[model samples]
Target: MRFFISVFIILTSIAPAWSDETRLDYSGRTVIYHSDVKLRGSQKRDVRYSHKANFFGAVAINTTKKTNDSNGAAWGYHNLKTAQDNAMRSCRFKADRPEDCVLYLSVVPKGFDFKPKTRTLSNDAVEAYNFLVGWSRLNFDSYRSFAVNGIHTWAYSASAPTREAAEKEALEVCEETFARSQKKKDPAWAKAVYLKEHLQCRIFVTFSPV
Candidate 1:
């Protein structure tokens, strides 16, 4: 009888453990997932636009009159405008230059099938690279976004032909650029020279081409 009781207790304990691994909670405003591809199971259901009133994502930074500071990328809000405002506010509030807060990125939680027309890319490669990586685009078919933001430096690529391939290439390029900066050994040479926190790949798809 003692052995049976012990066995039963072990099974019950492990059962909850197994369930915990697969358990996904999609509560208000938190990002459960971000992808162009559809998710399986209960995660497949869409977040109604009306429901989007409670969720928003954004990045913002302080200005130096001539340039923008690093350390933006605040996320998870309800209103886009409010998100942008709060992000900029956060930057300015913590910044040496308090008056130069600016919005760098913002997006609401969109559905899986959500796709928007692609805008014209920049003619200049450098500027285009910055624009693509820093800003979110309208959903277009086969689109991808990847970025690496480190201390005082960042890089990104988007709307590539392939998903994982583009992401890998973007990260590689970003890492390569970061590595070069490390080799140069600028003023902040002693600081860590890699994307320790902000390395990510995001995908969005749209049906219409514009």
Candidate 2:
């Protein structure tokens, strides 16, 4: 009985957390978006169990409006661009405004890498980095830290004089912003599941005076 209980705990801890929907930013970064409409069981299974190589897939949805045929998923394709195009085509067939159809999720091979220029950062993080570069130029003597939660959120601190203080401030700022954004997106489940499951802000870069 104890062994069974332990196994249950382990399984529960490793269970996948699936949101109602997901969104892809302009840079192809995926963001968890909450919605009342849930994916079908088969679609969810495709997303959860997709691991084959040379297989690319994508999910497209109409952001402007929701309809029975306004969202689609395509998988098991040999090419990424093909998968994306097919997904969009499927989604736009009955969409009121086909132009509103956007790729919300993309699935590549098990080892495929998106290789984003900003790496794990969102567009917001890139903007923060740019701002940090300018701020550091003016505050050259002060210690600075840059932190990101690795989930479309980031923050920086240039006012602190010590590395530890700068890191702490940056983490606090980043976590706060992350929490606020998650809560605004899905108040009911963001705090209980998403934040607790994925919130980890770490200092990625630090600056020291010469």
Candidate 3:
């Protein structure tokens, strides 16, 4: 069965909390989150203009310093993935530690809303989903696929040139992983889980360049 998983993966554990947490903008069309580091006059102007001009875009900033002059913004992109990638690329260009760059805000059109596939997943599954989505976004020109057994067990294919190849590989990896875990005699819980939720792997999400 096909499952459409949207963005909005839980990042509580993966990412550190921002000083200024994410919130809906007054206009209700934008979602924004700032950091402890204040933006300079030019940076503020750039952010204001980008949000106003683009229907979909993202902003990233280096949050490790009080004066975060290293920032990036991408607007007028066809998809959020590309916008996010470009923004991060721009921010990392100037960041002392590239890993310090974090996505600050993402703006979508007024009517856009994210709908998740399911909320009953375990915390580890949710984190896995986030990792899959993040990895897919890193390369806008590649096709990627993820598979899940409707529980904590999941796997993803590396970026491939074609959708079919990516999907096939993801399913293979997921099924193989599930099968391997079932034979682990050392972990009693593993065997128990395998018996309780022995679901077959199915394609969960697919990413294609816009």
**Candidate with maximal TM-score:** 2
lDDT of 2 at 34: 29
What are the per-residue Cα lDDT tens digits for candidate 2 across 1-210? 000000000000011223535444444434333233355534444344332322355666666655434465555443445455555666565467666565655655433455643433333355567777888889888888888653345678866778888888888887776566544343432332233433587888988865
TM-score rank order: 2, 3, 1
lDDT of 3 by residue, 1-210 (tens): 233333221010012336545455556665555455566545565467645642556677666542435566655433445456556666665677778777776666555455643423333444666876787677778888877764335677757789998899888887776566446323543332222333577887888875
Clashes of each: 7, 0, 0
The alpha-carbon deviation from the true structure for residue 17 of candidate 3, after best TM-score superposition, in angstroms, is 6.2
* Error of model 2, residue 139, in angstroms: 1.4
Top lDDT hit: 3
The digit string of per-residue lDDT tens for model 1 on 1-210 reads 000000000000000011111112253333322212222332211222213422344444334432223323333322333334444545554457755444433344433112453321111222434455344445445445434332222334455565555565555655555455445333332222112342232222211223
**Candidate 3's C-alpha lDDT?**
0.57
Q: After superposing candidate 2 on the true structure, give the runs of residues whose Cα lies further than 4 Å from its correct spot.
A: 1-118, 187-197
